[model samples]
Structures are given as C-alpha cells and as structure tokens.
Target chain A: MSLFMDLNLPFTADKKRLKTLLETAAHLGFSTVAINYFHEGQSKGKKEIPKPTPLAQLVDELPIVQGKSRPIKVLNRLTILVSDASHFRHNAAEYRAYDILAVQPTTEKLFHAACMTFDVDIICITVTERLPFFFKRAPINGARERGVMFEVCYAAAIRDSTMRRYTLTNTLALVERNKGKNIIVSSGTDKPLELRGPYDITNLAQLFGMSEVEAKDGVSSNCRSVLLHAETRKTACGIIYTVKTPNDSQPKDGPPLAKKQKTSAS
Target chain B: MVRVKSRYLLCEIHVSDPSKLLLLEDRAITAAVKDAVTSAHGDYGAAQCSIGFSVKYVNAHTGILFLRCPKSSYRLIWSALPFITSVERKGRRISCFLSCLHVGGTIRTCQKFLIRYNTQQLHRMLPKCKTQEEKDQVRRAILSSSTYMLKGKEHKEERD
Candidate 1:
C-alpha cells in the first residue's frame, strides 16, 4: 500500500507549536509531510525568501507514525504567490534550497502561464474565496500533460463555513474541467488541531466532487508523483552530474591501451 | 410494521473547558450536528440527515453520546460530525470536537462495547500511575466500573 502523505504544513516560527504540529501529524498517520514556506510576490522592496529550518534543528527526535513503526519523513517546500509575471524572477537562486517548488497564480493569465510554462512542480488552487476566473480546460490539460498537480487546500474550509463553500465550489469546477485527474488535497494549516487525519482528508475530498478512487489518489499516489516530479525538476530530466573525488586513480588520458580499440569499436 | 435499519454512532466530545459540558443537551447536539452537515456537505446532506436523526443519549460527565441515524446515510452524518468545532448554549460558546469511538446496530451492543473499551483504557493507564495509592485507586475504579455494568446486565436478563 502507498503510504499517506500531506504535502503542505504551513511554516510557523514557534518551536513548541511546530513540534506539536508534527506530533499531531505523526499521530494522524501521515508517513511524509512537507513544511510549506510561503513567499508572496516581491512587490515589497525586500526580495528575501525565508529559509527552511533543517529537520534536525526543528525537532530533536522525530515522532513515529501511527500504524507505521518508522518515524515520519519531513521535507521542505516553497510556495511562491505570483500576481504579476515579473513577481517570479527567472531561475531564482533562492528557490533551489527547497525540496519542492510550487506557485499560486492570482490572475487568469498568470494561472495559464503557471500551468503551461512554469518549471514548478505544483500549482495551488485558491480555496478561501470564489475563484476570480473560471478554470479553463486548455491550461489545465497542459498542466496534466506536464505532470504538474493542482492543489486543493481544505484547512480554510475547516475554519469557516463561507470558505467551505468556496473550497467546494472551486474544486468542483476544477473537477468538472479536469475529470478528477492530477489533483492533490492538503491541509494548509499552521495549527496542529486544525490538521485532520489523512483518511479524513480523503473523505473530505468527496465533498469537493471527487470519486472515491480519485480522492484516495489526491492524498497518496498523486502526491508521490509530485515529489518525483520535483526530483526531476532539480536535475536535467532526471539526469545528474557528479564531480570525481580526489581519491580517483583511474587513467586521466583514456582507458588502458588494450581496451581503447574495443571502446572505439562500439 | 416495517423495520427501518438504523446505525448507532458512539462518540466522545472533547471540550477545551470541561465545565462547559454542563450546557450540552439533546437538542443542542442535534442542532450542532445539523449545522455541521449543512456547512460541510450543504443542504442536500442536511435534508438526508433530518429524516432519521436522533440523539439517543448523552453523558455530559463522561462526554460520551450516542446518535442513531438511518443506516444508509449514517456515513454522511459521520463525516460531518468532525466539522463541529463548537456547540452553543444560552449565549455561551463551548469549543469542542466530536471524536467517534464506534458504530453499531443497537444501543445494547454499544453499551457492551463501551464497557470493554473503558476497561482497556484503564489497563493502558495503569502503568502511568506513579504512586501506589493512585495505582490502587485506578484498579478499584476499573473493577467497580466493569462490575457495575455486568451486574446491571444480569438484572436485565432476569427481568426479560
């Protein structure tokens, strides 16, 4: 069985609260969780993105996951909100430090661009209010083809009734356009009490118009795919370059003379 | 008479302030559950739940309550139960959560199960009681609670 994962846990500076959040997440049986550090558009003069706390520095001992004897896996994720095209600097060096990259597009044009062209691994779907623009099919299909998942957050819904309506309506619209494919559901909550169990999240997805299998995928398989896609994004289409260590004693020129001809023969 | 299948839900209410539990009533629970269903699932779910929804029992001291709904729509009610963040009573807001313990077909079965569950919880907490007096107190509490239920069951059998 695929282990359950919640890809977004809002970052909090308070150490005590953050520890409680992780402990609650572990008790809720999430095998993996990502601490989401958000950076709004750099409309402000300061362009500094907050750095993620290392796992060891964040918690002395990781809590064991419920029903899974092993400790939970923690990851760092960066979600950048794009309002204007210029807000996202091309190849922003600061983004490379995180494990996953995500973008929240505010405008219809930016949404299209983020889905079709952005190099990010995840696209966040706004859930606190009614979607400003209709989710068009072209960009959504492009995103699906590119292996980028659309994220639907449920924490806001849990907090307020009005937001619940917006969350369900916006997600249903997206589901209608995409036929329940390439979607992920996460709790965008900073409070430990606000976070629901992974199985609870799966059931909650049904309120957003997803079928049972699709809802299950929203919590498990699709998030797995997004993590793998983030890996490929770090490398050149899954290729990596390695530097030779000083201990390397192989021939600097070429292979041995005896094997040189055979190398050329191939 | 046509027998309508029913699902009995066993749940515990967790309140930040246990004193506020005194305000909980059967009507308040039903109303809170309706509001939760309406908000989480919308009007359609609320309407479905209204057909066969009733609060069977509430023990404010223990925070355990029983709800019985039409079997087919019990799941709809169950999912929305978690969304109830608080219950209102006489202008006082009691922040709380409804954590489900079990679901059964009859109240008798639920009672039997609750006894077993409480005794097991006692066993789990026995190792945590540091002082000898506390350990013995817990032991007496466990034995008395279990025997109380078993004695009640024996009387019911004799009366039947």
Candidate 2:
C-alpha cells in the first residue's frame, strides 16, 4: 500500500502550535509532511528568504503516524509566489536547504514558464480566488511530462464558504485540464484543526472531479512522485557520486575503488 | 418483498478538549452535518441528506456516533463529515473533527466493528499502565465489558 503524505503544512512561528499541527497530522495517518514557507517575490524592498527551523529545534520527539509503526517524516519546502518570470531565480543557493520547491504563478504567462522551464516540484493552483486564466493544455502537458505535480490545497475551503466555491471551481478547472494526472491534494494549513485525514482527503478529491482511484493516488502515490521529482531537482540528473581514493591513482587499485553509476530513475 | 437498504457510518469525534464532549448533542451534530453537506455538495447534497438520514447513535463518553443514510447518497454524507469543524451548543462552538472509521450496510455489523476497534485500543493502552493495580483495573474492565456483551448475545440467542 502507498503511504499517505500531506506535503504542505504552512510554517508557523509558534513552536507550541507547530507541534500541535505535527501531532494532529500524525494522528491523521500522514506518513510524511512538509513545512511550507511562503515567499512572495512580487513585493518590493528585497526581503530575505526565511530559513527553515532545524527539525530538532521544532519538536523534541516526532510523533508516530497512526497505524504506521514509524515516526512521521518532516521536510522543509519553499513556495515562491511568482508574479513575473524573473521572480523565480534559477537554481538559487537558498533553495538548496529546502527538501521541496514550489511556485505559485500569478499570471498565465508565468504559469506557462513555471510549467515548461522552472526546476520545481510543485505548481500550486490558486484556491483562494477564481483562476484568472485558463489552464492551457501545452504547459500542463509539459509539466506532466517533466514530472512536476500540480497541488490543490483544501485549507482555504475549510475556513470560508466563499473560498470553498473558488477552491472547487479552480480544482475542477485543473482536473479538467490535467485529467487527474500528476495532481496532489495537500493541506496548506497553519492550524492543527484544519488538517483532515488522508481518507477524508481522498473523498473530497472525488468532489473535486477525480475518479476514486485517482483521488486515492492524489494523497498517496502522486505525492510520492512529487517527492521523487524534488529529489531529482536537487541532484544532477540523479547521479551517484563515488569518492576516488588516492591509492587508485598509483595503479594499485582493485576495480578502480568505485565506479560512477548514473541512475536517472526520476 | 422490498427491503430498505441504508449505510451506517461509524465515526469518532475528536475534540481538543475532552470536557467539551458533554456539550455535544445529537441534534447539534445532525445540524452541523447538514450544514456541511449543504456547503460541500450544494443544494443537491442537501436534498440527498434530508432523505433517509438520521443519527442512529451518539455516545458522548466515548465520543463515538453512528449516522444512517440511504445507500445511494452515503458518499455525500461521508464526504461532508470532514468539513464539520465544530458542533454548536447554546451559541458556543465546541471545536472538533469527525473521523469516519467504517461504513457498514447494517448497524449490527457496525457494532461488531466498534467492539473490535475498542479491544484493539485497550491492547494499545495496556502497555502504558505503570502500576500493578492500574494494570489489573484495565484487565478487569476489559473482561467485564466483553463478558457482559457475551451474556447479552447469549440471552438474544435464547430468545430466538
């Protein structure tokens, strides 16, 4: 069985509240969760990107996921709100600290650019407002081919009824374009109460226009794929590095110590 | 003979404060569920929820409840259960969430599942007992509960 994962828990400053959020997520049977830090690049003043808190400083002992014998895995994610093409810096040093990178494109052109060229794991579909531009087929297909997953967060829908309409509308539009391929449903929530169980999310995904199997994959297998894609984005085409021993240069080597293996599984 | 088929949803209510569970009422949960269904599925879901829908059981002490709905529209109700964030009592909201544990065709099957679930929970809690008295208390509680259930089952069989 595929492990359930909720990849976008909004980063909160309060350690107590963050702990509760992590505990709640673990109780809901999420095997892995990512703490998402939002950075809006459109705003002026040259603000610095926020650094992720070390996992040790946040929680002393990680809560074990319910029904799963192991403790929950926490990862840091950076979501850059891209209004213009230049907003998303290509291969920035700051992004290396994060386990996953995502972009929320404000305009259609930026969306196209994000899908086709950006080296990111996730493209967040705007759920707070109506989608301004239609999701063009070319960019979506390109993203799918490149193994970039599209994310639809359900936190906004839980908070307000108006946003719920927008969430459903935008999610349906996305589903219509993507046909439920390479889509993930994550809870972009700051509060612990807003987190829903993985099965609950799967049921809700069906309401968002995904088939039952596709809905299940949205919370499980597809999220795993996104994690794998993020792994590839961090590496040089998923290359294996081998350390060259000094004695090997003296022609006293047995099988050259280690051979470099290139595995582009992602 | 045509028989009415319905789905029983076994759900556990998880609250941030356990004391607030006393404020929960069947009517409030039903209202909250109805409100969530209306918002989630719109007017169509509301119509489906109103027909053959009822809260079959509510155990405030255990924070468990059972909801019955027509088999055709149970998914609408099951889907809406997650959106219910609270149950309002006397204009005050008790923040909570409903986690659906199982969906059964009949209430009897749901009850059997609940018994098994509770036993599993008891096994998990057994290791946490620090003192011998506490461990004995848990063992006695488990034995008494299951024996009482068996006695009731035997009486029902005798009646048949």
Candidate 3:
C-alpha cells in the first residue's frame, strides 16, 4: 500500500503555501511526493521563463512541519519539446540527475534512443490537438505522406499505452530485458490540479490493459524506486565514504600507509 | 581451438546455506586465470567462460539458482545438472535458456559469489560448462553450503 503525491502545481512565492501543500500531502497518507517544475512562460509562449526554486530550499522548509511523517519522495518533472535527437542527448546529459524527464519523440528511432542511451525512465509523448507546424508543409496525397502521419499517430497511441502499463507489464519487461535500467510511468500533467492520485493512476493502468498488481506497482513501486535514486544522489553529494567505523579503519594486512597509521594511532 | 557458434548456458545451483557459498573469494578458487577468461570471453569459439569458486549464492536461504542462457557452445552442461560444484566450458558463445534447481549451502556463500561476479551474466553462463560431474559439483557446493538463500523460493522443498 505505498502512497504517492505529485506537486506539479504552480508553486506560490509564499513559503507558507508550499508548507501547506506538503502538510496536506502528508495528511493524505502519501509515503512519497514528487515536485515538478515547469519552465514558466513556455505554457503561454511567453519569452520570460520563471526561475525554479532550489531543492535545498525546499528541503530546508520541509522540517518546519510539526509531526513525525513518512518520507515524502521528491522528483523533478521536466518536459522537453523534442525537435532533434541531439537536443534530447544534450538535455538528458544535463538533467541526468533528475528523476524523470518527459519527452515526446517525433520518431521511433528517437524514442528508442531516448529510452536506451539517454536513460529516460518515463517518456511522455504529448497528444496535441494540432500537428506541429513542421509537419504541415510536407507534401500530401501520397502513400509516403499517409505512412508518415500514420507512424506519428501510432507512436502517440503507443506512448499513451506505455504511460498506463509503465508500472505493470512494460516496466517489468524493460527491467527483465535491460537488467539494470529503470522504467517509471508518469501522467506528464502540467497542472497540479490535473495530477491523479495513486489509486486513480492505477485504475488508468487497468483501463490501458495493466493487471491490478502492475497498475499499483507502476504508481507506487516504480515511482518509489526513481524517487529514492534521486534522493540518494542528493544526499550522496560530497560524501563518498559510507563505511564509518573504528573496526573498518583498515585491516592489519592492508596498505603500508594504512598499517603505519594504525600502529601510530595505537 | 574448436570453432563453435555462439551459444548460452543457464545453470541453476541450489544450496543449503547460500551465505557460506558467498564467502569463497576469487583467490579461493585455484584456477583464477580460467575463471577470468570464462567471465570475460564466455565459452564461445576458443574462449572458455565459466564462473569461478567466487560464485555468490544470492538466494542462500532458499538454496535455488535461477540461470538463463541466451546462447552457448555446450548444451550438455544442462544435462549434467551442475547445481553444486563448478562449470568448465571448452568453447565460445553458448546457448541461452533458463534453469532452476535446488542445491546445498548458505545465503552468505552465494552473496559472496554474486559480489565477485556479474550474477546475471554468470547466471546466463551456467549451462555452458563441460561436464555433468563438474556442473553437479558446483550445484552441490552452492546448495549445501551455508551462505545465501534463493530469493523467491525460500520455503520450497529442497531437491535431493
């Protein structure tokens, strides 16, 4: 019964607002919470992008709440408008630390690479009402044109299905096939209010043909694993040595320098 | 040097105490060079890949080894039923398939082997070993030792 909450809403400049949201999520019995930041003005085509709040600042404010609570998993949700393969490669490298980077691939090769090389755990193929401006000028009334459009449409449908089965069958298959790679399913919703609960998300999985176990795991376990990885990276910063104990100092037959230190200390 | 097509071997070693099996280090095996070659090149062509004595039994408690061979040189390794001892292969790339079996040993020994080698890759390489006797010994050593436990099959009955 793992619980999760997504904080993809427009965060108020007020610290109190953020605290209230966290507290509300905690009260709602969520074991994890994901924080998504949108590149402001991109939604409206405005040139000015809103500055994102730092993770450290958010962590600092988290302790302000009063009671003992389950650890709320935090993740950064990034949406990229994919125009080229190089763009995805560059962005993936830059945001490698992020838990999930949602991208809508224009081609099957691009999508495959996104999942493979870039380590994209969740790929959100955007379902747009109108095709991108670039596709408009292409020649029509031919089989090639229809084939291109058909592939694009099929890809979108597959992506939607992927989002639903991410936790269940697809993720398991990916894990089985790739061994160490991780795959997570995300709604890729822009608005916080639009974000679905864990149960609803699971139900959506069933609607998309995911089994009950698969649906639950997609939203809970898969997301949990991703969030934990992000948390590990965050906390592991500058702390390389985890083994800290007097007995772990060094074995008697270790390096000469280590033995010398042991002798001197003794 | 036998020119054999690429094949895989899937060997499942079941042990009593898997944890104990995990303790066997690379140095524990007298044949380090053979083990290294087997791990790197696999049992395809002239390259004879095999898991050394440092095999870590992850499911030490349950005493089960789940092996998957995608492709391998020798298919007879599977017939040999090497759940306890060591696997020695003569050629390159083996066949790929899955094998599940119970053996001896603790969860610790299996863990040690897992730590030293790539468990998944090694798991895929088990069935490519040379003889049923060698395979059986490896399986017996893995299953009987007190090292690790088979992850999902902890409560299942042990094979004789």
Candidate 4:
C-alpha cells in the first residue's frame, strides 16, 4: 500500500510528551501525522486563533518511519469544535496557516452544514460521548461527493469503556449511512502508547463495519486524497499556490520583486 | 457429507514480563478476546463468538497459541484480537498484545506456515546483527540447523 498516515495527534503544551508521541507514531509506521489543535469556536469570535508551532520547533529531527527509510512528514491541522451555526467563520484567515482544516460539529444542524458545505478536509465525528443525533444520508452523501472525509479517533476508546461505546456507536451510525466511504481513522492521542499501528487500525475499522479493502484505504489512500484536497484548497487546483516565486522564474527575465509579492498576496 | 469448516489462528502473545506469560490460561485469553468483541461489536458478535470457539494449543515458553473458531466468524474474532489490550490473572495484569501470525483452514497449515515464517524472520534478522561476532554466530546457527535438517531427512528416507 501507499504511505500510511495518522492525521490527528492532539497538540499538547508539553514538548517532551509531544516529541514522544511523534516518535511513537513514526515507530508505528505512520509516514504522515498531523498535530491537531482543537479550538472550541463558542466564545465571541476571538480574533487571534492559536498558531501551530513549526515542526522544526516541535521536534529536533523527525524520526524515520518503522519500515520506510524516509523520515516522517508532520503537518499542522486545526479542528474547530463548532457547536453553533455561526461559530465557523467563513473564509477565516487563520485557517490558511494550517495544512489541514477540520470542523467537529457538535449539533445536528452544524453537522449537516459541516457535511454539506464546510470547506474542510475532515469532519470529526464525536467519539467522547454518544452522538447527539443520527447521521442522515443526504449530508453524508454531500460530504462524500465533496471529497470531505469523516474522522473517528480511537484513542478515546482505548482510554475509557464509556467513550469506547460512543466511538463504536457513532462509527456504526456513520458507516451504516455512508457505507465506509470517505472515512479516516486517526489516533487523537496525547500519550505515545495510545497510538496504534496502521494494520491495527485497519482491523479495528472492520469492527466499524468496513470491509478489508475500504478499511485499508481509510488509513492510506483516503488520507492521501484528503491531503491532496487540502493542497488544492490552499492553491488553485494544486497549482499556483502562490504566484510563482521569483526564483522559479528564469532569473534573467524574472518579474520584479514588488510585482511578484503583490501577485502572491492575492 | 457436509464438512464442518473452521479456521485456526496462529498467534503470538507479546508481553513485557516473560514470567506473566505463564499465567495466560486458555479461559482467560478466551474471556479477554470475547470481552473485546462484545465491547466493540456488541451482543451479535458475542453470540457469534460463543460458537465452536476453542483454544487448540498454548506454548508458554514461546507465547504462541492456536485458536480455532468457526470459519464464518473467524474475521469477527480475528478483528477483536487487536482490541485486547492485556490479559490478567490472580489480580496481576500482564500488558500484552495478540499478533495473528497466520490464519488457515486447518491447524496443520497454520503450523507449517508459522515454522516457515519464523525461519524467514531469522534470516531477515541475520543481516541486522550489530557485530561481526553476532553475524558469525547467526551464520553458524543457521548452518547447523540446515545440517541437522539434512540428517533428519536422510534418517527419514532410510526408515521409509
């Protein structure tokens, strides 16, 4: 299979713990991992969204994947816990900083909106508590059509049996409706031990109603597609992310710095 | 006559404490696996799990075991193995993981595959030795094993 990825690892203030978590993820053969910063968008719209630390600052050196010789790829992701319809700011500038943007809609109405229209790479399904509402077909279909994936974190399940019930219940509901399409399973973990291997997650996905192929895809190809979608979300169709940097142009005939910067600013 | 179909799972239990491996009884492993299945998949899985499930063998030294389950529900049981975080006995918990080495229609096939797979693993580890002494030791061990196998084969041929 292609590179396996765990797209969500909870961001913590403790650097050592985060480093160990990253090391554990790398050791488990996750080629790509995202440091997830959870933001509850409930208060009077805080202008300054928390910024993700650069990967260099987070860890001195990325560990090589267990089987792959290449070092792990780390990305930043912002997961907005959207409880109200107005909580999600449309075209928020803060979102541009993150490589992946996700929204965890707590209510059915917000969930429907997130599934149908949110310009997010992933929609986090609640695993900490029983789903507040049933997953409807229309919204899930919309999400599938738009290439937005739903995320189910398994760390909660390993921690508490109650959360495990909720994780299974919510996963089953989503699977029953979507039939295992566009689902990404991640370890929303802070500790190193909570992270599981890719094959382990695939087997666990079978418990979530996915067949072998779909479960395998959920961890590998589907996450790749999500990353691609995020790339496109940043750039215009994965090309022209920023007006061609001056160095990319033939230096002899390159555009002026001011003009290039202006074009990139747009 | 209809054949009664079943699947046998060859598994290795990975535990931090080797001493605790002695406490892993068939019943306790069964309970742990069943509890994981019930928690993950609920009553339907539990009902399916109770059918024709048996522990064929347990190797305490190697921490290997063969679990037999009805062919139809093998995946259900197999999937639940990853959820088994540990095994407990006498109020002492041994943190362990169940890794399925092979699954086959018969225990004989599983046993054959495990033997071959383990040999392959040994071969793979030979090159990863850090020192020349270790490399020489592994090479000598492999040569001795192969010679031993050749002698056994000759003896078997003579008997035949």
Best-matching candidate per TM-score: 2
Per-residue lDDT tens digits for candidate 3, residues A17-107, read 5665564444333555555554321333433323456767855544211122334555555555555665554433446445544455556
How do the predictions measure up, each by TM-score? 0.76, 0.87, 0.36, 0.75
The candidate that achieves the highest lDDT relative to the unseen native structure: 2
Candidate 1: chain B TM-score against the reference chain B: 0.84
Query: Could you tell me the lDDT of residue A256 within candidate 2?
Result: 38
Query: Which stretches of candidate 2 lie above 4 Å from their native place?
Result: A42-44, A241-266, B123-160
Q: Write the per-residue lDDT of candidate 4 for residues A125-146, one digit (tens) a residue.
A: 9899888799889999999999
**What is candidate 1's CAPRI-style docking category based on DockQ?**
incorrect
Deviating ranges (above 4 Å) for candidate 3: A3-23, A39-52, A55-68, A90-100, A127-196, A228-266, B1-160
User: Looking at candidate 2, what is the lDDT of residue A223?
Assistant: 91
TM-score for the first chain in candidate 2 comes to 0.89
lDDT of 3 at A154: 14
Measured with C-alpha atoms, the lDDT of residue A191 in candidate 3 is 25
Model 1 misplacement above 4 A: A43-46, A241-266, B1-3, B8-28, B39-44, B56-66, B89-91, B99-160
Provide the lDDT at A25 for model 3.
Answer: 45
- Which portions of model 4 miss their true places by more than 4 Å? A13-29, A45-48, A60-67, A243-266, B1-5, B10-27, B38-52, B55-66, B99-102, B106-160
Each prediction's DockQ?
0.14, 0.44, 0.01, 0.19
State the DockQ, from 0 to 1, for candidate 3.
0.01
* All candidates: TM-score of chain A: 0.89, 0.89, 0.50, 0.89
